[model samples]
Target: MTIDSPSLAPAPPAPPGDTAVHPTPARTPSAAPERLSTRAKLVLFVLCAAQFMIALDFSILNVALPVLGKDLGMGQADLQWAVTAFALPSGGFLLLFGRIADLYGRRKLFLTGLGVFAVASVLAALAWDPASFLAGRALQGLGAAIIVPTGMSLLTTTFPEGPQRERALGISGTLLSLGFTIGMVLGGAMTDTVGWRSTMGLLAVAGALVLLAAPKLLSESRHPQRPRIDVPGAITVTGALLSLIYGLSTAAQQGFGSLDVIVTLVAGVLLLAAFIAVESRSAQPLVSLKMLRRRSVAWGNLGGIATFSMMSTVVFLLTLYLQEVLKLSALQTGLIFGVQGALSAVAGVLAPKVIGRFGARNTLVGALLLQAVFTASLLGLGVASGAWLALVGVSVASVGHLGAIISYGVIATSGLPDDEQGLATGLVTSSQQVGITIGIPLLSALASAHVAVLRDGGDGFAASTLGGIKLGLGVDAAVVAVVAVLVAFGLSRRADGGVAVGGRTGGV
Candidate 1:
C-alpha cells in the first residue's frame, strides 16, 4: 500500500526477521491507522513542536546572555558557561540517548525528555546563583539530547521515502530555522521587558504543552526482543564526550596549556579511545562501529561538523559585534539577526527542490562553496563598508548555510535502513552540536587574541576588535571551503548511485 505522506512512505518494510526482533506496536487502531490517517497529522504536529522547542533553546539564550550574566553576577567566562552547559550535554549524550530510544521506544523517550526539559526550565527560571543556573541549563541540555534524536527517528519511521517525507522534512527544516529566529527576537523582548527569567519560563510552558500533546499523537515502537542497554558503553562514551567538550570549551578561556585543561583533555582522549574499543567488541554496541567504517557516514559527519562550526561561530561573533561594537539595542540586534534567520528559513523551504534537481551531493557541494564565498565576503566589509552591504552579505551567507544544512540532512539519511536511522541521525546531529560548542569558544578566543595583538601594536580597542572579527570570519570561510573540497572529491565519488565511502553504501 502507498503511504500518502511523502515523509511516511516508500521505505521498505524492515527486513523480515527484523520485525520480530523489534516489534514496535502500531498506534491505537481506534486513534488512527499506521498507513495514513488524520491521526498521523497530529503525530507530526507533536513531533515538530518538540523539535522546534529544542531548536529554539539553542538560539533563544543567545539574546539573554547579557542579562543572565548580570543577574547571576557572571563575567564573560561564566556567561560562556551558560551556553556551553546546554550545548555540551545536548551534543555529548546524543548517541547514548538515540540508542536508548531504539532499545526502548521513541515516543516514550520523547515524552520523558519533554518532562525533564520542562522541569529544568522551571529550575532555570528560579535560579538564584550562577551555579544553580548552570546546573539547570545542563539538565535542559540532557533533556534536549534525548528529545531531538528521538523526534527525528519518529519522523523517519512514520513517513515513507517520497514527496510526503521530503515535504515534511523540508517543513521541519524550515521550522527549525524559524525557531532560531523567533527565539532570538523573543529572548531579546523577554530579557528587555520581563527579565531574563521569563525566557526560561517560556521554554517551560512550551515543553509542558508538548508533553501534554505527546500522548495523544505519538505511537510507541515495538521491540519484542529489546536489546540490553549497554551501560558501560554509554558511560564511557558520555564521560569521554563531556570531558572533551569541557576541555575544548575551557581551552578558550584558560589556554590549552592550563593544568586543568590538559588533564581534562587527556582524560577525554583516553575515555573516548576506551569507548571505541568497547564498541568494537560489544555484542550490541550503543553505536555500531561498522557504521563508522562506512566512508559516507564518516565524511558526511566531518562535513557536518565543519559546516555547523562555521555557522555557529559566525552567529556568535556577529551578535557580539552588533551589540558591543555597533552599539545596537537588544531589540535592534535581534531585528538584524532576524533577517539572516528569515533568509535561512526560505532557503530551507526551497532546499528539497534544489536537491531533487541537482542531486544531493552536487547540491551539498555547491551550497557549501556558496557559503564559503559569502563568509569570505563578510571579511571584506567593515563599519565603513555601509550597513546595507553588511546586511546583504549576512543574508547571503545565511541562505547558503541553511541550504548546506538541508542538503546534508537529506544526503546523510539517504539509503539507511529503518533500524539504523535513529542512531545515525543522532550521530550526525551530535556532530553539529559538538561543532557549535567547540566553534564558539575557539572563534571567540581567536577574535580576542587578535584584538589584543592589534591593540598592543597601537590600534584602539574598537578598530582592533573589528579587525579581529574580520580575521576570524576569514578563518571560518577558509575552513568551510576546505571541508567542501573534501566532500566534493572524497564523499561525492559516485553521483548517479548512492555515495560510497569505506566500501559501504547506505551509512553516508
Candidate 2:
C-alpha cells in the first residue's frame, strides 16, 4: 500500500541571482544508497518502535479513561481535557518541529523527545490529581510532536527511495496501525487487572527502552546548510494550529456554539491567514510554497488527512456503539479491534506489492473507495444484534485503510529532495497527527448535536444515540467517497501533464 511517485511538472528554475531564497531542489537518492545490512534492519526496528510508541499513546488512554476519571476525581467536562491536552501539542507543534529538526538534527531531536516522553509518562503514572496528570499529558504530547517528524525523516533518508523504502514504510505503517489497536486492548486488560496507571507506566518503560536503543542505531541528519529560522512563519502557524485544535476539541465536548469555541476558532483562522502571508514573503519559508503546490504533496496529503480522519472516527464511534449502546465490556470491544489489527497488519505487508502492480495513486483511490463501501455498510448496525456488522465492516475496511495509510506516505514524501526530507515527512506526519486529533472531535460534535436535537424532539436516550451515530457514519462514508474522487482526478491531472518523480518525467 505505498505510493508510486508519479511524474510531476518540474518547478521553473529560480532566478539566477536569487541565492538567498531556497527553492525546492530536485531529489538526490544517489546521496545515500539503499542499505540492506543487518544494521539497516536495526535502524528500522528502532525507528518503528518509536513510531509504535507514539501511536499507542494516542489510544491507550481511551479504554482506561473511565477508570482514570473516577480515580482522579475528574468530571465528564474535565475528562476530555486529558485527551485534548496531549493532542493539542502533538498535532500543533509537528510542522514547527519538523523544520527545526531539519535545521538542527533529527537524531538529536529523536533522543531528546524520547527522554521527554519517558519522563512525562512517569509523571503521569504517579499523578495524584487532575492538574498534575494534565501537565504530564501536555509534555507527552510535546515529546510526541518532536519524535514523529524527526523519526519519519530519519526513516525516509536512511532508506533510499524505491522498493527498499517502500518495504520499510510498509513495516512502519503496520506497526503504527497495530499500535492503536493494541493500545485499546492493552489499556483494557491493564485497567482491569492492575490499574489505569499501569498503561502510563507501560509507556514509560517502552520509551526508556527505545531511547537506549536509538542513539546507537540512528545517525544525525539535517539540512546540508543551516538556514535561519523563519520566525514569523513559525509563530503564526504554531499559533494557528494550537488555536484550531483547541477550538475543535472544545467543540467536541461543549458544542461549537459556545463563545469560547467561536473566539478561538476565529483566532485560529486569522493566525493561519497570517502564516500564509508570512511564508509567501519570507526568503526562507518554513514550508516552501512551491512544494505545497505539487500534486503529490497536496493531493497526497489531502488523501492522507481524509483517510486517517475518517478511519479513526469510525473506530472511535464503533467503540462507543459497542460499549455504550450494546453494553459490551471494554475487553470485548478490545477483542474485536484486536482482530481488526491482525487484518491491518496483513494488509500492510501486502501493500508494497500492490503498489508495484497498480501504482500508488490508483491504490490510494481504490483503497479509499473500498474503505467507503465497507464503512457505509455499518449503517446496518442495529441496537440489538449489529455488533457482528461492526466487527466485519471495520475489519474489512481496515484492509483498505492500511493501504491508504502506506500509499499516502509514499506519495507525499516521494519527490522531495534530501534537504527537505524533514519538511516532507513533517507534512506527512502533520496530516496524520492532525487527522487523528481532529477526526473524533469533528464527527463527535456532529453526532452529539444530532442527539441533542433528537432528545429535544422527545426521543429516548437509546434511540437518540443510535440515530446520531448512524448520521455520523453516513457522513463519514460520503466524505471518504468524495476524497477518493478528488484524489483520483487530482493525480490524473498531474499524470496527463507529465510531472517529475525522482527526477524523471513520466505518467504515474
Candidate 3:
C-alpha cells in the first residue's frame, strides 16, 4: 500500500516551446543548484497570506451563522449544512489536490487555487439563498483543498532545510493561529455592522491581493518525474471521507442508530478499504501509505484528531453557553472569545521554543495534560457560577489547547522529508478537519444523553442543558487525557533522537 517517491522514476522530456517557462536542464537538481533569493521571501509572504485566508474561512463563518441563517431563512438543518459543506470537501479533496500539485508545478497549482478561491468567495458574497450560499461555500472548500497543500509544498521546496525552512514553517504556523482568531473578531463585527456577505467579500479581497503578488514573487519549482494520476484511488478516498463526514453531520440531527447513519458509516468504511487496496496496486498513489508506517506521523495524526475534537467541541459549547446561558450579545461574545483567540496567538508563538526546550513529545504530553485539567475545571462551572470564573476558565483552557495544536503541527511535519512534506501536511490537516466534523455530533450526543438522564430525574430545561454541557466537557477532557498518555508512551519507545522511521527530528 506504499507509494514510493516519484523522484526514483524516469522523467519525460519537456516539450520544445515549454523550455522558456520550465527550468533549463543545466539548472536542474542533478546539475548546478540555485538558491532562493530575496524575491522568494515576497512569494513566501503571499503564500502565507493565502493560507491565512483559507484557515480563517473555517472559523470566521461560525460567528456569522445566526446572521446568515436569518437573512437567508435557513433552518437548523440548513445552517449545519452551510458549515459542514465547506469542511467536508476541504478535508476530502486535500490528498487529491496534493497529488495534483506534485504532478504539475507547485507554484502553478498554488496560484491557480488562490484565484479559484477568490472567485468562489465573490460568489459566496453574492448568494441570495441558502442553497446558493452553500454551493459557493462548497466551491470555496474545493479551492482550499488545492491551496493548502500546494502552499505547504511551495514553502517546503522553496526554503532550504535548516534555519530557513524552520523560520518559514514557524511563521506559517503562527499565521494559521492568527487567522483563526481574526476570523472570529472580523466575522462578528462584519455580520453585525456590514452583513455576513461583506465578510465573504473581505476574503475575496485578501485572496486577490495574494494572487496579484504571487507571480512577481514566486518561481516555479523543478518539475518532478512524470507521474500518473491515481484517479480511482482519489475517488474512493474522497467518497469515503465525504460519506463519513456526512454521516457524522447527520448524526447531529438524527440519532446514531438511524438507518441512514448506519448505512453511510458502513459505506464509508467500505470505500476507505477499497481506497487502500487501490493505492497498494496503483502505479502512482495519491497518498503514500508507507508514510503511515512512521510512528511519529501515525501517532502525531492520532493526537491531532483527539486535540481538535476537544477544541471544536469546547468552542461550540462555550459559544452556546455565552449566548444562551449568559445572554451575551454577539459582539460581546466575540470580544470574549477574542481574548482566548489572542492568547492562542501568543501560545502559537511560544510553542516552538517550548518544544525545542522540552522536546516535541514531552511538550505535547504536557500541553495535553494542562488542557485536560483546564477543560475539566471549565466543566465544573455551573449555570450559577460567576461570569468571570467561566471566562477565566475558557481563556486558560484555550491557551493550553493552542499550545497542544501547535505542538501537534510541529510533531507531524517535523519528521517528513521535503518531497513528502505535502503528504504529511495533507494527512494532519485532514485529521484535524475530521475531528472538527465529528466533534459537534459526538459532543452533542453526549450532552443530549446527559440531559435526558437529568430530565428523567426531574431537572428542568435550563438545569438539564447545563448538566449536559458539563458532561460533554468532561468527556472531552477524558479523551485528551488518553491522548496525552498515548503520546508519552509512544515517544518513550522511540529512539534516542526521537526520530520515527521515515521521519526526521530536530526542528520543534
* Best-fitting candidate, scored by lDDT: 2
lDDT ranking of the models: 2, 1, 3
Off by over 4 Å in 3: 1-41, 160-163, 495-508
The alpha-carbon lDDT assigned to residue 492 of candidate 3 equals: 51
What are the per-residue Cα lDDT tens digits for candidate 3 across 1-508?
1111112222232212200011011122210112334565676688789888987998888878877999999986668888778887888888777777766767788888888889989999999888889888998988898898888777766654323444456567667766876798888888878899998999899999898888877766523574777889989999999889889887878879989999999999999999999988887788877666555677777877887888778877877777777677878777877787777777766765665455566667888888888888886666765457667777777777767776666666653555566677778678777887898899988888888999999998778888888889899999999998987777556444444322122333
lDDT tens per residue, model 1, 6-80: 223223322121000011112210111123456666777888898889888988888778778888899887787
| Cα error, candidate 2, residue 146 (Å) | 0.4
In candidate 3, which residue pairs get closer than 3 Å at backbone N, Cα or C atoms, i.e. clash? Answer: 415-504
Q: Once superposed on the true structure, which residue ranges of model 2 sit more than 4 Å away at CA?
A: 1-25, 28-35, 495-508
Error of 3 at 136 (Å): 0.7
Quote the lDDT for 275 in model 1.
Answer: 95
lDDT of 1 at 271: 95
Candidate 1 — what's its lDDT? 0.75
Which 10-residue window of candidate 3 scores lowest in summed lDDT? Answer: 18-27
TM-score for each of the candidates:
0.88, 0.92, 0.87
